[model samples]
Target: MKVYDDKHIKNVVFVGAHNSGKTTLAETMLFEAGLINRRGTVENKNTVSDHHEIEHERGTSVFATPLHTEWRNYKINIIDTPGLDDYVGEIISSIRVADTIAVVVNAQNGVEVGTEIIWNYIDTYHKPTLFVVNQIDHMNASWEDSIKSIKSLVGNNMVLVQYPLKIDGAQCIIDVLKMKCYKFGKDGGKPEKLEIPEDQKELADHLHNELVEKAAENDEELMELYFDKGTLNENEMRQGIRAGMLNHDLFPVFCVSALMDMGSGRLMGFIDNVAPAAADLRPEQTVEGDILVRESNAPTALFVFKTLYQPSLGQITFFKVKSGEVNLNDKLVNSRNGETEVLNQLFIMDGKKREPVSKLEVGDIGATLKLKHTETNDTLHEEGKKITIKPIKYPQSRTRKAVNAVNQKDEEKLNDALRKIHSQDPTVEMEFSNELKQLIIGCQGELHLATIDWTLKNIYGVEAEFKEPKIAYRETIQRSSTANYRHKKQSGGAGQFGEVHMKIEPWYEGIPEPEGFNIRGKEEVDLPWGGKLVFYNCIVGGVIDARYLPSIKKGILEVMEEGPLTGSYIRDVRVMVYDGKMHSVDSNDISFKIAGAHAFKEAFLNAKPKLLEPIEELTVKVPEEMVGNVMTDLQSRRSVIQGIDSEDHFQILRCSVPQAELAGYSTNLRSLTQGKGTFVSAFSSFQAVPRNVQETLVSSN
Candidate 1:
């Protein structure tokens, strides 16, 4: 393999909805580029991408696969990403490093929910994108409807560069820019270029004018030239299109039947000639807000965008060269942890296969065998250089489940396996909640959790069960009350005796001193988990020794840690140790601690304790027709509607609902909206539960 400079490299990512033929298009591109002798189909499960066992079993892509091919003196690195919303992490990571994104659209279905979801990410990164209206060979495929849908759903910036030409019941692509028709053979390889037919020439001419105008709009000079000459030369048009694409002012749409390999060769040629190169992309901002540009002669730096744990290869780290070139045996420091690792071997990936490469130049994507401390989002640079790339921001886990190993003794094994999986894919969050006392696994959706389960059972030989996780409810007081308790044990020798008198009240930002109480000392402490605990030492004239005050506060904290109401943690409470009695011989730290605990428990019960449930702010986007149904469903879940916003034909509903009601909401929402709805939620605050619900929870606890 030959090392290519930055100008010769093209990083393109294929992203779209599930079953949109991204993998198929990628396979066709590889075959047409002569990288492979025969194109692999998704049904056979032999495509270059989607090689994982889970992907094969599910017949969908689960991980982003990197493959490369050479076309017309350009080395095109094609990143095939998963289309399901569950694996959006892959799409996001790939988009971060891609100079251009080819958003594949299903010609039959048009713009779908998944497409809209992924489009938001592309817009977030502000990447130059093109639409590939794929699967045009289907009998029901309507390019006109798909284009109309794209224009309505995405924006009006879409301009057609190619249109489908039906020849003897077979689909051919007529390129507007080249003014030629590419007709494929029975095997769909090496298309024959012919002049546009008379009937299609009129439509092609109109599309060509539109394309030229869209491209010229990006440059003042190009616009002037178009006005003067009423047209642009082939070279000038290509340059103008590249500028428009890089500026995101124009998104060209092309038609292709990836399954039949019709028009894919022309698409590859367009990508190679017109797509933006790495050098054309905007410089990446560093963690410290400094810009770093890709330069072949600059200091060597690579950003790890994805990590994989291959069964044979322990940890395979995929990275893009951000600055300079890197050769084998070069030692690089992990900017994240300052750990040094030698690049023992560098390899280019084709699906699951690895081909050795001596060096990788700037803007090129490659993988290295093992790094001690390097993982996803870590920046690897030359030793002594402190450079860190901006990390990829992954979406929060929308669903979670409490996982338990079938065999209790295998709990450790299951945890170890989960940790490995997390290291490979950080999108899955594994946490042990002390309050809930459950080992929870949080992921994008149910399919993501299911994939983890399959991996545990088949890959690691561990069987686990997933169940609804317990809600982390809290206990607090609504009113102030006073209670006293004396702990005395005079069995034999020195007796254990202590008495505590304390007043408990709800704490707020401007809480006033309790009536008939003097503030001796006040300390505000934030809890490790959340909320705050304000301790007021209102003891007068050493009624309770200052030394014993610490013991009393400690005891109060123990009760707060495990509330007396339902064993949940208590928060935002002020405790005043107004008065107490102590025996010199028996009233040690232990004695005061026990007395304080008893007194606090008694006062908490008498002060009108209330149960608080965690509430999450949810933002749901559904079609306008389904808003009523979704709102009704949310009302049943005890939701408080905040406000609504409209986006085109979609309605965005904002509400606050209890976390308990969110269980299985993802699946239910999908079913209710026929897979056209999407939502995101975040913890808002803890609110008092309804009286009936509180009673049920307390009784169950």
Candidate 2:
């Protein structure tokens, strides 16, 4: 194996919807590069990128797999990303480091909801993008229709760089710029170029003319030259097209059948000549404060994007050096913690394999093993360098499931393993309910949780049972009421006697804050740190001791942890210890604790208490034909339609729906749209459940 120099590097990410042939295309690229002796299939569990046991068994990618190849003096670092929405976090990590994103679209399926998702992220980041239409050999595949869908989903500026030459329905592409036609034989045999078919010259000419027009539009000089001469030379046209692609003025589309290993060689030319190199694309880095640092001379600064926990190999954190050079055993300080650690060794990763390198230059992506303080999203820089790099913002995980160790003995191991996993992947989070005695694991979706389960057993040597997570609900008061409780126990030499007279009312709405409350005429009730908590002294003639006031307020706070209606904690309620009696000798924290518990129950029951459930803002992307069905489904789930927008033959619907109503929403939406629609959800705010539904929740809890 040979390592290409830094100047020839090209970092590209392969992304798309599940079953869109991203992994297959990655395998094909590796095979064409001669890095692999045989092609691996997803169904037979022998793919190069999907090497993990879990991914192989499931026949899908769960993590981003990085591979390297030398094509035309270029070191192409290919990152194969999972196409499923459940592992979207993995895709995000891959895209963050990529200089260019290649969105793989299925020929038969055209544009899917997931494809639109990847497209939106790519556009948001303003990264240079390419559209690769894969599986063209599939029956009923239409290249023209697929290109039309791509243009509609993307923009009309998308140009076909390669033309598919169909021979007996086995699709093979012709490099339009090269002016050569090729055909594929049986069972992944080597491709052979043939003379251009007589009937296809006009069709090829049409695509070629369109591409040339786009190339001319990219350069004013070239456009004027074309106007004067009526044509552009081959070299001038290629230069124009490359410039247009780098500026994002045009997205060059390529057609290929990865299963047959066709059109990959021609695709390499586009990658080497047209794809932007890191140095070409990376903006100059500068200090935020007094000092300034350029990419050419700045001390080494690497941003860790992804981390993996291998039981046998410890922790491996992958990073991209934004500036300077990182050498072996170099000491770097973590900006977040200000702790220095030795770099040890830098390794350029290829799938699960690593090739150790002496040093990594600026704009190079590599990984280091067994770093103590470094984690994902952390920045490693020179010592005393108080600088921070921006982190890639990943979409928050919306789906959650409760898990427990299947074998009682593995409970502690499961907890420790999950924590390790979370440390490795920030996208996976865990929530524990002490009262409910359940460990809820939050992920991208159901498949994500399933993959975690499989990994836990296969890789971590721990087994767990997973169930749907229960909604985290809260109880709050609706009406106002007053109650009093007396605690008088005479069991020992010193007795306890205390009483609490307090009123409970619903907290003032419209953003719960300190200034939202005014104690009418009381001057001492204004506290800055206290939110929605008001203490009033309404005693007529010192019925309660002023010295014991703080104790009474503390007792009220302790009782607020639980409401009468449910075990969930109460929030935004103002409690006033207006008047209470306390025995100076016996009344202490313990006595007040008992009185507080009783008084809270009475007041809470008197005041009508209700349950509140968390609501989430949802954005569903679906084909235009399924908009009505999705809207109807949203309404059925008690969702409030905030707005809707149509773009590129798809409708994006935004709404706020209760989290409880969205537990199985992914599955339901798939069924509703027949696997053509999906959505991303975000936490909005906690809102009160309807009075009629509160009973059902409370009883279930």
Candidate 3:
């Protein structure tokens, strides 16, 4: 491997829906470029990208892999990404370091849910994008309908660059601009010029004309020449098309059978000629964050988009050098952690293999073996130089489950494994609640969490069990009440006497208020009950001692924690010690504590206690075909649909759904749409459960 300067490097990412041949296309590209002697098939579990044991067993990609190659004097750094929704975090992380994205779609399936998702990612980053209609050799493949679907789902800027040439009952492509047809399976299809097939000439001309028109539309002079003469020179069209693609005004779609190695070389050539480099695709910023530098003359700064945990190599950090140069043994500071580390070696990574490099210049993707403190989303830069590039935003987790070590002895081991995986992936969130006695793990979907569980057991040697997480429930009062309690205990040597009168009631849910009502349009009374406990000296005649007030409040909190009904934590209640009596000699803090505890418990029992359950503001994004089915399903869970909005080609349905009812919503949503529908839910607020539902829960308990 060789390090290319910013001007000669191209970082490309392969992205698309699940089972869209992204991994196969990447393997084909690597093989055709001679990076790999023999092409590997994913079905055989021999591919370079999906090398994890879990991935091989599941026959899907779980992480992103980097593969490097040289094409026409250009260094192409390719990132093969996972297509499943659960593994989309890998796709996003890969896109962060890419200058261009190749969205591969299955010809038979046309556009899918993942197609729209990856396209949105490309759009978000404003990167140059290309479309490859893969699996053309499969039966029921429709190139025409796929193009229309791409155009409709994406925009009209999707132009056909080359039309497939069906010659001698074999699948191949005709270079429309080159005016030559190439047939496959003959002499191994060395890309020799041949007469254009009669059946493809008409489609080729129409597609070529459309491509030329779109290219011309991007340039005034080209548009003038095209309108006057009905055609433009090859060079003129080339320049125009390049500009259109860079400006995101056009995305050229090409057909290919990646399994047969057809159109792979042509696709690489198109990328080399049309794809923009890092300096050209992304606006460079000065180390001072002043002027945007189009050329690479500034200080060194690289963004760490991903962190890979290799069993033998330890932690490998992957980053794209945005500006200047980074050399072996160079000391770089992590801007995020403010820790400095010396790079002992630099390598261009290919799956599990590494090609050592002397230095990685600007616009190149490189790796460093294990940094002290730097992790994903961290910036590595020269000391005293600050450069902050925007980090990619990942979608919120869609699935959550409680995890526990299969054996209590493996508890610490489970936590250790979780931390490592979480550090590598920003989308997987791991939390623990001492109250629930469960370790909560949230991820993109059920498959994602399951994959993590498998990895924890296999790679890290820790077995774990998973279950639906328990919602954090709380108890509060609904009405106001008052009670008085007196504690009198006499012994042979000493005596204890104390009395407390307090009121208990509901306050504003979020705001602290008085027991009965919150006074408005008036300044808050300087009552002693402001901070958790108030002792109103309405005892003007020295009824109770002001010295023992703190003890009473402390005792009140102790009783509040142990609610009378279900032993759940209580909130939104105010206690006021209006009046009390205490024996001067025996009424110490202990005596006051006992009196307060009994008084608060009496008042709470008299008040109307109710259970509060958490609700989430759920926004479901699904295709229009599943909207009705999803709506009806949500209704059964006691969800209230707030409204509906449009999200590009999908529907965004918003509703307030209870957390209890959404225990397995992720799995259910997938079943409803046959793995096409997905959603995100966030904590909205706590709402009281219906009486009937509460009765059922209470009885079951």
Candidate 4:
């Protein structure tokens, strides 16, 4: 493998909805570049990009696969990303490292729900993009309708660079910019270039003029040149188009039938000659707020964008040379943790196969094996010169499930497998909820959790069961009350004698000291679990020794840890140990602890304890037609609608819903909207449960 300079490297990511032909397009491009002997279709489950076992079994991309093809003295690194929302982590990581995005649209469906979702990420990254209308040769393909939908769904900046033409029931592409016709044979390889047919010449000329104008508008000099000469040559047009794309002023559209390999070769040619290179992209800022330029002569720095576990090869770390060149045996320090790893071997990844390379240049993507501490989002730089790149921010998990190992002995294995999965895919989180006493796995959707389960059962040899996760509720006092308890027992040797009189009150911010009370010593401490605990020692004449106060507080904390109302943790409560009695020989730490715990529990019941349930802020996006039904369902779940915003054909509903009511909302929403709805939620605040619900919860407890 040969190393290419930054200027000759183009990092393009393929993004689209599921079954939109992104993987197929990538395979076709590789075949046209002579990198592959023949193109493999998704049906045969032999495509280079979707090479993962799970992907092959499901016939869909589950991971972001990196491959490269050489065209016109340029190396184009293609990052083929999954389209399902479940694997958005893969798409986001790919977009973070890509200079340009090629958003593939299905001709029959145009922009789909998945496409719209991915487009939001593309916009977030501010990546220059182009649209490819794929599968144009399908019997039910509608190029005109698809283009119209694209214009409406996307922006008006979309300009057609090529259009599909049919001659004798055979599909061909007419390149408007070059004013040439490419007619492919039945095999759809190595298209025959010829003059535009007489019938399509007029239409091609009009589109050619439109493309020229769109390109020229990006630069003053180009606009002047176009005005002076009434037209621009191919080279001049490409320069303008590249400038417009880099500035995000234009999104050129292309036509392709990836399944038939009809127009992919020309698309590859356009990318090689006109797409923006890594050097052309804006400089990235470092963690220290310094700009980092992409230059081979600069200090060596690499960003690990994705990590994967290969069955036989251990971990494969995918990274891009952000600055300078990295050669074999060069040791780099992980900027995140300061751990160093020597690059003994570097390889340019092509799907499952890797081609060994001695060096990787700046702006190039490659993978290294068995790095000690480097993981996704970590930066590798020169040991002495510490620098960190901005890490990619993934979306929070929207769905959760409680996972339990089938075999008690496999609990360790289950946790270890989950940790490994989280390391590779950070979007899937594993948390042990002390309040719920369940091991919960949170992910983007049902498919994501299902994949995790499958990986655990198949790869880790651990069978697990998944069910609705228990909600983490809280308990707190509603009013103030006082109680007295005495613990006295004579069991064989020394007797246990201790008495405690403590006042329990609900704690709040800006709470004043208790009125009509003589205060002695007050210490306020923040609980590790949340809320505050204010302990007051108002002992008169040392009725209880000062040393015993610590034991009393500890006992009170034990009761707080396991609330008297329910098993949930208590928060926002102040305990005042104003009066107590103790015997010198019998009132040990254990004795006072028991007395204090009993006293606090008695006062908690008298103070009107209440259950607090978690409330989450939900932002849901659904088709306009389904808004009424969705809102009704939310109302049934005890939700408070905040507001609604309309965009295109969709409505965005903002609501605050109780966490307990959202047990299986993901599955329900998908079913209600036929998988056209999506939502994201975050922790808002904890509110008291309703009276009826609280009664049921108390009874169940």
Q: Considering only N, C-alpha and C atoms within 3 Å, which residue pairs clash in candidate 1?
A: none
Give every collision pair in model 2: none
Query: Compared with the true structure, what per-residue lDDT tens digits does model 1 show for residues 1-701?
Result: 98999888999999999989999999999988999998788889888887888889989999999999999999999999998988888889999999899999999999988998888889888899999999887888888899998897667789999988778865678999999998877667678888998899899999999888988898899999999999997778888889988887789999998888888888888889999988888778788777786787788999999999877888899999999899999999988788898999999998999999999999999999878788899999987767898899998888899999999999999999999888777889899988888999889888889889998999888999999999888889999999999999987898888899999889987877677878889988898767788888888877678888888889988998888768899988898889988887887888889999999999999999998999999999999999999999999999999999999889999999999999999989998998889889999999999999999988887
Model 2 misplaced regions, further than 4 Å = 1-6, 166-172, 183-195, 282-297, 384-387, 406-412, 432-439, 502-531, 571-585, 617-622, 642-656, 674-688, 698-701
Q: For model 4, what is the C-alpha lDDT against the true structure? A: 0.90
- Candidate 4 C-alpha lDDT tens digits along 1-701: 77799899999999999989999999999998899997898889988898888998888999999999999899999999999988999999999999999999999999887888898888888888999999898988999998997887667788999999888877889999899999888768778998999999889999999999998998899999999999999998999899889887789999998988888888988998898998899888999798897788889999999999876898899999998899999999999888889998899999999999999999999999999898899999987877899999999887888999999899999998988898899999898987678999889888888899889988889999999987778899899999999999999899999999989899999998887556788888898777788989877888889888888999988988888666888889888888888887888888898999999999999999999999999999999999999999999999999999998889999999999989889889988897789888988988999888989988998
User: Sorted on lDDT, highest at the top, how do the candidates line up?
Assistant: 4, 1, 3, 2
**In each prediction, how many residue pairs overlap at the backbone (N, C-alpha, C within less than 3 A)?**
0, 0, 2, 0
Please identify which of the two predictions, 1 or 3, would achieve the higher TM-score against the true structure: 1
Which candidate has the highest lDDT of all? 4
The local lDDT score (0 to 100) that residue 184 gets in candidate 3 is 81
Please, what is the whole-model Cα lDDT of each candidate in the order they appear? 0.90, 0.78, 0.80, 0.90
For lDDT, candidate 1 versus 4, the one ahead is 4
Cα lDDT tens digits for candidate 3, 518-553: 222112223231213233333435677777777887
